[model samples]
Target chain A: MKADIIVDTKGLACPMPIVKARKAITAMKTGQVMEVLSTDKGSLNDFRAWVSQTKNELIAHEEQNGEYRFWVRKL
Target chain B: MDEKSQKTTIVLFSGDYDKAMAAFIIANGAAAYEHEVTMFFTFWGLNTLRKEAAVRTKKGFLERIFGAMMPRGAEKLGLSKLNMAGMGPQMIKHVIRKHKALPLPQLIELAREQGVKLVACTMTMDLLGLQQEELLDGLEYGGVAAYLGDASDGKVNLFI
Candidate 1:
């Protein structure tokens, strides 16, 4: 069974949100998914780029109620 | 590692002198890893790349005041909170200079030699009335869209 970890990095600035998200997902086993919520517009790009560096998967990204929702699957 | 991955883009938006130098350090590190690197300089980041200024540190009050009056790039500023170990500023300057690190212009040239792309923000250039000649040569002018597009396919997108 895959786990789903949710990270709320709503108010953090550049590097912090993605840094935290990367730290969180690394503990998970392969195929587990992590969800991240952020308010910084730059975080979207930052997170996506970060995911590319690691062997993780960015499964989905959606914006709702002024918050960004990102889902990443551990690789 | 696959041979097909494209390089990353780093956008630095700082007016501080030290931080800009750190940004260049980071870019050089990334380039050493065989990653394609692109750096976009905007706002205070532009001052470091200016052609005519050679800002040096001064010790005395008069020289300090004169140094203040002179144009120092981002590398000359105080260290960040993450680097404040009391000797952080001194250590940073020592390491940077000891590395025979090129000045911003020479560093940009070295980056070009290593295949790193240098870009300046067109919007900020217009706002500051900076001409192409005022900037180091071989610079591309663009906006946020340009950076985004370059970073869209990148594995590393850093904002320093």
Candidate 2:
């Protein structure tokens, strides 16, 4: 079953958000969706790049209220 | 679903010696767990890629004296400062090295064996007067645009 999960990594610094997001994605079974919310500006590019290199699915990504939201579907 | 479909990327942004150690440890650990790891060294982080004065063999007396007067090795690398706190940087390094269960050189070698891609920032290399030959062999030279393009996939991107 594909589950939708939210990983709120707001107020975290660089590397941590990505680390947390990776942890969440790893914990899930295939086809699960992990949404990462981060305040760190670097996460925007970092997460996007990560998705590409790992063959994970970047379903959606956006910015709102000074926060960046990324949706990743586990491969 | 297939095992070949799973992968991870860790981007290191820190140039600090301690932070580099921590970042390498985590990256190597992930590789040990069968994750595909890519390490992108940029900005101050490029210090690790310096082949000129990065890692050097241990020195004896006269060599030590000469090294003291000259650029010794990565152990005395710039921005890789020794902490003035309790144990200081040297001791801290010793402790970390001991606890991490691998020498710095071995860790780097493991990264290579595990197929960890080494990326050197072209801009940083230019600023440091380092040419392609000045870095370890098999280094990928590129700019932020290149790194972004390479990292465009869905994986893990870390900045140490």
Candidate 3:
């Protein structure tokens, strides 16, 4: 998936990754996609919950080699 | 989003560094979700708002002793368990740095930048004989009623 920005939150713990993702997504324009690379296992649920709570949309998400990648579009 | 309805209020009653970190992390997370966040610091929790430099003030002997016994500020706070004479807090700080996680001070700063309200309990301040100058800047002061006013309508209310 293509994204306007890529935020690397690897090695960060719970809440930090989501915090960084929120900041990154907010700085982006509406409809612009953000790719978040996080290593925290909790990112899976964090991203889903964050998307549900905020105005953003989680377009796609996947796990690879212990890393969680999420594609979120600003709304 | 309905700003009024999406509110989170946290009553920070613990002075432990780890506990304070958790509170700020959750508060920051809630703010990220566009919720209005308020953190009320009372009793020991107010220590988290203390400045690194001690403020000169007039106080009774007991009040002075209380001030001397408590941790000076957020940077000087010790862990609640396995503190081992302050070694535990250092270890936790090392681990946090190794993981590239934002430390407590930075998290508090970010929380402020995100518009999370940091409120100091006025009654506690009086009881502890703490002056306003003793605390860090950018804070709101209030009593239990003030906390209740904010927490009453909040969807998420926590005591930590």
Candidate 4:
């Protein structure tokens, strides 16, 4: 629900959204939370898969209209 | 994840602009995820790493021709399909710019910034008469064995 960083990846294509999120997460301290807003439909799965692979926790995600918001916590 | 699971190896074997773009996008993405990324440039793929300006290098008659015929760098590479005798790459570049996406050269720069290893295939360089000075600097030189060493331990190995 709360985030230390907010990354806007709206209208970006595949990889860019995830790329931005990765950069944001890297700069955060352990246990810090990030909110990512992405309009790229593919990022829904990409972010989930990437978070799992990197061992980060995807606290929750929701979709409104065509936009998606994800709350990720760095473990 | 373990180190191996966070490792990705790619063999770039195409000379097309679009293919090279895709490869670098994936490589950058993997590196963004904090994965160890290695891209081995082989065959025509070596063109992607060539220096745009012509360098002063003495070579045999055939070597000079090979050097002249191939695209000098990432900017000059043609597309694999819909080349349209060169118009295709231009259109692709236009849209890429419109989309605010990183161009091939910028992607390569990002990859370098992200510490993704860029290796030039020595055998291919020799065969194509491409001197070390003809390619972008700060690259590792190796053959297939070197690629295999990285790929064997890599969780994701790709031959593009």
Residue A68 of model 2: what lDDT? Answer: 93
The DockQ for candidate 1, computed on C-alphas, is 0.02
**lDDT by residue for model 1 (B1-160), tens:** 2576467788877755466656765676455444677888877676566556543432556534543543444344445554574376667566656644444444555566656777899898665555566555677888888888889878888888
Write model 3 residue lDDT over B1-160, tens digit each, in one string.
Answer: 4644499999999999999999999999998888999999999999999998889998999888888888888889999998899999999999999987889999989899889999999998888888788998989999989999989889999999
> Candidate 2 or 4, higher lDDT?
4
Give the lDDT of residue B156 in candidate 3.
96
**Where is model 3 chain B poorest over a 10-residue stretch in terms of lDDT?**
B1-10
Give lDDT tens digits, candidate 2, residues B43-93: 556656556454444446663453344322235443346555424656765
Residue B155 lDDT in candidate 4: 82
Model 4 over residues B86-156: C-alpha lDDT tens digits? 99999999999888788899889989988899999998899999999999999999998999998988888
For candidate 3, please provide the TM-score of chain A on its own: 0.95
> Where does candidate 4 stray beyond 4 Å?
B1-5
Q: Superposing all C-alpha atoms, what RMSD in Å does each candidate have to the true structure?
A: 12.8, 10.7, 1.5, 1.6
- Candidate number of the best lDDT: 4
Candidate order by decreasing TM-score: 4, 3, 2, 1
Q: Pick by DockQ: which candidate is best? A: 3
